[model samples]
Target: MSQSIFILLILIPLTFTQSVRGKDCVCDLKNSDPAFPEKKLKNVETSALQCTRTITSEKMTDLDRLMLGLQQRVKQVEENVIVLEKEDDRNLYGAVSLRIIELEIAEIQDLLNKLNRTTQNYHHLSVQPAAQLEVMKDKMAELEKFDNMQVIKTNRENERVKRDLEQCKEELNATTAAPPTVLPARCGLGRVVSVAGPRTYSLTVFTSYTYGAWGRDAQPAPGDENKYWLVVLSTSNVYGNFIRQYGTLSTLLLGIGPKDTYISSTNPTTNTIQGPNMVMYGNALYYNCYNTYSVCQFNMTTRAVSTVALPKDTGYSNKFPFAHLAATYAYTDMDFATDESGVYVIYATTSNFGNVIISKVETSNPPVLNQTWSTSLHKRTATNTFMVCGVLYATRYLDQETEEIFYSYDTKTKEERFDLKINIKKMQTNIQFLNYDPRDHLLYVYSDAYILTYELIFQ
Candidate 1:
């Protein structure tokens, strides 16, 4: 019976141990149930993945918007660069125009300064005139005190002196009335040895026209001896279509008695004057024709216009102007000069390599080019030129107040001289026009609106 009881206890303990192991196995299996905590963990992982995907998509969209804005900014910057470039080009052009205007202003200022200096000189002379007037009054008072008895004896002596003066004046007048000595046909006055005083000076009526030509007619008709002609470049200081004639020097200085002869009412026409280089001779005006390499002659009596074409390849229209270091006189490619011989046109030609070329112009109905002369001197080097006894004299800028006659070319002997040191005293900086008047043996200078006359002394 004791053995049976112990076997029972062992069986009970085995059954208990089996029950504990089974229960533990059930608890472990519950943790791995599909519909329980495992399913819940899978749903939570899906939710987190969806949230991450949404956030990534939104960030990519924001990056796309930022790239688009950067592209627009780049386009705007390119457009601004283009506008700036155009503005820079316009500014550069404006600067060039301003430079030209500045040069013109400087020229005007120089002219004003010259005028001021002349006024100051006149003021000094005027003071002397007043002082002289006072001295004359005092002399008159002293003369009045010495009258009465001295007066009768003085009158008798004066009458005797007057009779002797009258007899002497008659003899002197007879001698002075003798015929003048005739000169040679070509070089009538001979070589110019010296230039004498600027005997006369006057301002033009239109002083504002800074460039012009004015002088007495080189070959005037019988009734027009005292007549003077003027051509003021009324258009841009370059062109005019009229010639002004004054009866006398008094009328010219007074700006009265001007007879305007219009070559053409419409300027820049076929017969209009193109530049300041002009001459009135034989009742005709000779000048450069508008827009042509030719010379035009307008007869005052007949109102006829005649033109003669220059040589082939003749430079004109500012091609070969009177140039110097300081400035250039534009459209002065053709210059009309007259001397004892006749009218001549001074110009340069491309075929002659820009050297001075001269041609004689016949003063007939249709003026013809008679003879052509070429010189080695360059046209641009000369500031002005004139003809004297068939000799071409070229002047250069020496100083603001002086011009040097440094070169001459004689058509008679084909001689060239560069050593002539004859100097011209100038009242201004530039001589816009210069011509030698054979009638009075005078040099007519039109310089910055002042008309000056200098006598020529010939050997």
Candidate 2:
């Protein structure tokens, strides 16, 4: 009886509260009446706004307005089917949105499950590999121990063996590096005959001026060149060293030096030249007795000189003007042209292309010509440089096309190489003279005071 009374007391209050919810109090009822009080309507308005905020859809604000309007319209009993139709779409959209949320949750749960499974599989792999790794580590340690033992055994003997090998290597090196027992004066290459002078030869200087009675004195002063001596060697080398010593100036070639300038090395009183350009045949010196036109054997090792005929005035005007200790000049023939031996003297001609005619030198014959060669070159001004055979020659031709610094007349091959372009541009002047030495491959070019050397690029 007491338990029944306790149950009745609890049911009586709960049943009374349920009855009050079905009545028209907006806050306490399960649903509100259309004619609810203002205060209750305010509460409903606040709750609706809260619900609107919890919805994430973009149309939630408009949907809340439509829902409010429908409730108000239904309260007024207005004739409107469009508002109901819109309300129906809102309910349908809510259903569709709830389904999308459910799908998203299901997808998230599926990804989480997959991740957990992967983590489990990783743990299982770790458990399976741990023992095998420990076994490998143990084997590796044992192999390392074996290697150490082998190294220790070998190291015990390696030091002594290395020392013995080093000692033997040092002994072998010392024996091989020592000099030989004896050395000879003349080594592997036998008896070298070293000479710096040219082999001796003769020359024929043709002159009409007699020095003893008619012409100028034999020994002339310096800066004077008229009468000169010709020194030719056996190798056909010519040196005019005899010029400054005993030459007569202002008349013929080979001008002599001043009285005190030149002294004879052999005949001091007679004023003979130092012997240069001597020809050595097989190992002996050759000396021709006199400067004559006819070839006559004066010594067993001597070489003779003959007159090559020339065309022009050969006695005075065309002779060598100074003494030189170099190759002797030879005229090719009787005419002012190329001779048989291919020796020639060049002269600039204002009439034709820097005209050049070959004239042979002989003591008896008249000036003759052998061949005529001309190059169309003219110089505008001085200071031009020309290079030939490592020597620089200049141009003195007062014309337009002469800008050469060096020039070469190759007789053996009959070729001429000239620096007409380079010499002109470099010097900014005309070339006057040129000398070339083919053996040394040197070209000495003159540009004002500058001497330039150009190595010939030969084919």
Candidate 3:
């Protein structure tokens, strides 16, 4: 009976264990059981691990794309840096080349100044320096042939230098010493001793015209003394046919009371004005004729056009004109001026080697050339020329706002003076036209687009 009880206890224990296992199995099968929840959590963990792996792969792909883009950008930046470096090198080379050219020009100019000084000192020496001068000129010619433009520029400079050398040679070879200095014969209003105030300043009626001529009538009629005349070169700042007349100085200053007089009613014809340099005298407007080397006089009362052909080979159409280092006045080859004596035309001729040639014009039926005078002054070197008291005064550019009357040629005695230092203040850089009104002793200047008048001081 004890053995039987032991067997029952063992079996009961085994059956109890089996019952717990059965309950476990049943809980696992039921979805709402806690054991089932644990098993479901394990499956969810496995799924989450798989999803994380997939997301990691996608992040790696995006990282690879970003890395590739960064590499391309770095390459582009390197290329740009290389291009900039090459450009900088080229710029440096160009700057160095320009500097070298400038230095060469300066050296040539210095050599020219030295040559001028040597010629000036030859007066005290007994030996003729002709051979030395020739050698220097040869050197200058070689230097001038650097370029075509340089050749043109240096040719003008060399002309002046050659003239100076010729003068020196003449002085050296003279059998007799230079004559004693004789005081210049004083004519009407003596020499221009000084320049005074810019008494009147008037921007003209046409402000857009940058080049023009303006003044009162040098030889006025009875009732036209107070009338002021202006001619604006409207076409290319070079050609026009209209003359604008203002009644008085007040009217001119106010840009009011204008009367337009057309030389020709049609398009620019032979009688039309050609250049900026023009003047009014005795009810007639004198100007350069269109497309010709002649001076045209348009009579207001008669409405008649009279032209006188200039000397043959007279510089026209910008072959020669008033020039400075900066610019040249185009088509101003013929400049008309009126002095105490009479009317005159100042021009340059190739026959005269581009020297200033003055001719007296008689205001008869057909204005005829009366007397011609040649001066040693080079035409292109002077910026503008005007007559005062029968003396031709030439001005040169001193600065942007100053013009120096550095030269004079008296027609009475044929005397030339180069020591004049009278300076006139300027409103602008360029003076396109200049005229002296003998009636009022005033200088009428057309500069840029302004009409400026200055009172002259006589000694």
Judging by lDDT against the true structure, name the best candidate. Answer: 1
Task: lDDT for model 3, please.
Answer: 0.74
C-alpha local distance difference test of each model? 0.76, 0.30, 0.74
Answer with 1 or 2, whichever has the higher lDDT: 1
Q: CA shift at 321, candidate 3, in angstroms?
A: 0.6
Model 3 residue pairs with clashes? none
Can you write out model 1's per-residue Cα lDDT over 252-351, one digit (the tens) per residue? 6556548998888987677788878888889999999998998998999888999999987999889999989989997899999999878999999999
Window of ten residues with lowest summed lDDT in model 2: 193-202
Worst 10 residues of 3 by lDDT: 27-36
Q: How close is candidate 1 to the true structure, as a TM-score?
A: 0.60
TM-scores of all predicted structures? 0.60, 0.22, 0.59
Q: Report the lDDT tens digits of candidate 3 across residue range 62-81.
A: 33433433343344334433
Predictions: Cα RMSD each: 44.6, 48.5, 38.6
Residue 198 of model 2, lDDT score: 12
Candidates ranked by TM-score, best first?
A: 1, 3, 2
